[model samples]
Target chain A: MSRVSSKMALAVKCSDTFNADACMHCGVCTAVCPMGIEMLPRKLFRYVQIGLEDKVKENISTIYSCLLCGMCAENCPAEVNIADNVRFLRKYINENEFNLS
Target chain B: MPLPTKDILGILADNLNQRKSVLPISSAAATRWAKGLDLPKGGKTVLYTGHLYQLIPIIDAMSGQMAKFEDSALTKYFGLGRNVNKFINMTFFMGMMASKDEQKDYDRMLRNIALLLKKADVDFGYLYGEELYSGALVYDEGVDGSFAKHAQRVADMFKKNGVEKIITVDPHTTHTLRTVFPEFVKGFDIEVKSYLEVLAESGIEPTNQITDDLSLHDSCVYARHENVVEQPRALLAKTGAKVNEPRLCGKNTHCCGGPLESLFPSESHRIAGNRVEQLKEAGGSIATMCPICLVSLRKAAKGSVKVNDLSDTLAKAYGV
Candidate 1:
C-alpha cells in the first residue's frame, strides 16, 4: 500500500515494448484466478499506457497474484505475454521501493 | 539416465556431519545401495519410491524434523536416538515406484500404518489426490490420468467417512479438492483448505522471537496454481522477522528445479543457485513452504545460504 516512486513509474512506462496494448479488457484472467481475487489486468494495461502509476499500485496485489501460467497469452488475440507484464509490474513496484529508500 | 547415487550420498554425508545429526536413508533403497549390509533383527524400516526417498529425508533433516524421528532410518544407520512408533512416508513416492504387482506390497505398508494408529486410538488418513477445480483443468491433460477417476474415489471416501471438510497439506491437493473435484463429482459438498491457511485462520501467534531475516520461497504448487502468496508472508510477519523479497518471486517464481534435479542435475543446480543468490542478495535465511522446493533448493545451495521449511522456522520460533 506504499506509494510508487519515480523508478517504478519509469519501468511501467518502459514496459510498453512488452505489448501492454494487446489486452482486450475481457475478464478471463480474473475468472480463472483460483484465489477469486479481481486483478483487472485490462485496466492495469490501460493505466500503464497512460502513465497512471497510482492506479497500477493501488491494484498491485492483483498483479502479484497472477499465476504467470501464460493462459492469457494463449487466449489473447494478439498473443500478448500478459504474465510477463505482471512480473514487470512487480519488479517495478520493488525497484520503486528500493529507490524511495 | 540413472541418478548419481554416490555423489548424492556424499553430499548427504557432508550435510549430516556439518549439522551433527544422523541422516536416515530409506531402508529399501539403502539396502539395495548397501547390498551386503546385514539387517539387524526387529529393526524398523521405511520404504519410499526413489524420488521421495531422496527428497524427504534431506529436507526434513535440514529443517530439524528428521531429528524428532530419532528411531528413523537415519538414526539406525548412525546408531543414535531411541526408536519411536512415528514414521514419515509419502503416498506419491509409493505410487511412482510400485510395480503393478508391488502395489499390494505398498498398500500393505500403508495398512500397517493405519493399524498402528488405530491401536493408539488415533485416526489416520493419507492426504493424496486433487483439491481444486483449476487443478483438474491442468492435470486432466497431464500424465497423471483423468481427474474423473480420482474425483469419484475421493468423493466416495468422503461420503462414506461422513466427513464435511478436508484440510490438505499440499496446495496442489487443496486447490483440486476445492475447485476441480466439484466439476466431476457434483454435489461433492466438502470444504477444502490448505493447512497453512487453516492455521492462519485460527489466529495462532508465534510464541518465540524470530529475529533472523527471512526470505520466502513460494512453492510453484501454491504460488502458481493456488495464489497462496501472502498467507505465509503474513505468518512470518507475525513472528516480527524481517522478510526479504527475491528478484523473481511469487507468481513468476522459478521452480526449485525439483522435477529436473535427478534427470538434469547441472540445469537444476543452475536454477537452484540462481534462486539462492536471490535469497542471499535479499540478506536473509530462505524459508519455503513446499517439501519439494525445500529439498531441491537445499541440495542446490552448496552451503552458500541457509534454507529452512516454513513449518520448521515457525516451530523453532514457537519453541515447539
Candidate 2:
C-alpha cells in the first residue's frame, strides 16, 4: 500500500485553479508563526501558483503546523490568502492519492 | 402557567445581545466578589457546582482554604494568581463584596447566571451567614427550608413557563442546571441544552458566503464540555465552503487562552496566537461557537484569519 493510503485523507479536494499570485515572498509569516516551523509564505504561494503540488506537499508538515491566525495575511503587501491556501493544501493532501517518494 | 414564548425569546435575545456587546467577566469573579463581602460568618455556603465555565473562578473562590486549591494549577490552566496573596485576596476572596452600584452589577450578573443556569437545570440558593457558618445544612433535604423553597419556586416558574427547551450558552450553567440542580429541585421539567445545539437544530444557514477555505476553533465550552464538535462543522459545511479540520479539534480542542485573559494577557495572546496558527495550518477563515471564544480568538487573531460566530455565519447564510 502507498504511504498516501497510510495517511488520513481529507474530505475536500483542492481546486486546480487555486492561485496565490498576491504573495510577496515576504518572511513575515515565518517570523510570526508560533510553532517556529520555518516556511516562506511567498515561496509556497509561488510553488502552488505554478502547479507544483509535489513541492507544496513536501513541506506539508510546516504548512500543517500553521495556526491560521492570519498575521501574515495582514502583514502581506500582496494580501495573499496564505492561511486559506494552507488549508486547501491540507485538504488536497488528505483527499488525493500522491506518491511521497 | 407557561410563560409566553415571545417574552422568553425576547429576554434570551436581549441577554445574548448584551453578552455579545459587553464582555462579562467569568462567574469566578462574581464568586470571589461575593466572598469578599464578608457575609456574616454564620452564613450557609450555597455551593454553585458546575463546569469550568465562568463558574471556575467561583469554585476556586469557595475552595480557597482547601489544601487541594492549587494556585499553580489555576495559573497553569487559567494563568491567574501569580502571587499567593493576589491569588487569595484579589482573584479569590476580594470579589465577594461590591459597593451598592457594584451590587447592582452583581445582581445583573447573578440574575443572568441564574437565568442561564435555570435553563440548564441548575438550582442556586442564596447563602445566609448562619447556615454557612454553622455547616448544619448537610446534603439532606429541608436542611435549609426557605432556601430550598425559593429554589423550588424558581424551578416551578420555569416549568410553568412552557420552557420545554432550556439551552444554556455557558457550559457552567449547563452542567450545574442539568446535573446538580436536579438533586435539589424535584419535578423540574426543563430540558437543559447548549446554545450551540439550538443553533445547529435551528437549521440556519451560514449567511456569509465564505468562498475562501476556513478552519474551526473548537472552544472548550462547545467542544469538550458540551460535545458540540459537529454542530459548527455542520453549519460550516452548510455554506458549501470547505473546512480544514485542525489537529487539535473537538474534545482535544485547545483553550483560546481565555482563562488566563486577566492574569497573563500577553501569554494568553501567545496561546491564542498558537491556536490561530493551528487554524491557519488547517488553512482558512476561523469559525467558533462560544462568544468568549470568538472574542478571545479575535484578539489574538490580529486579522490573520477571519473569526466569526456560528450564528453570525447563519445570519449571513440566511441573509437575515
Error of 1 at B173 (Å): 2.1
| Interface RMSD list for the candidates | 17.2, 22.5
Model 2 segments more than 4 A misplaced: A1-101, B1-162, B170-172, B183-189, B202-212, B263-267
Best by lDDT: 1
What DockQ does candidate 2 have relative to the true complex? 0.01
Candidate 1 CAPRI classification by DockQ: incorrect
Cα lDDT of model 1 by residue, B180-248, tens digit:
577668798777666566556656666678787887777766775577888777767778788888876
Give the TM-score comparing model 2 with the true structure, all chains together: 0.40
The candidate 2 chain A region of ten consecutive residues with least summed lDDT is A4-13
What lDDT tens digits, residue by residue, belong to model 2 across residues B76-117?
A: 422122223222333223235323443443233333433333
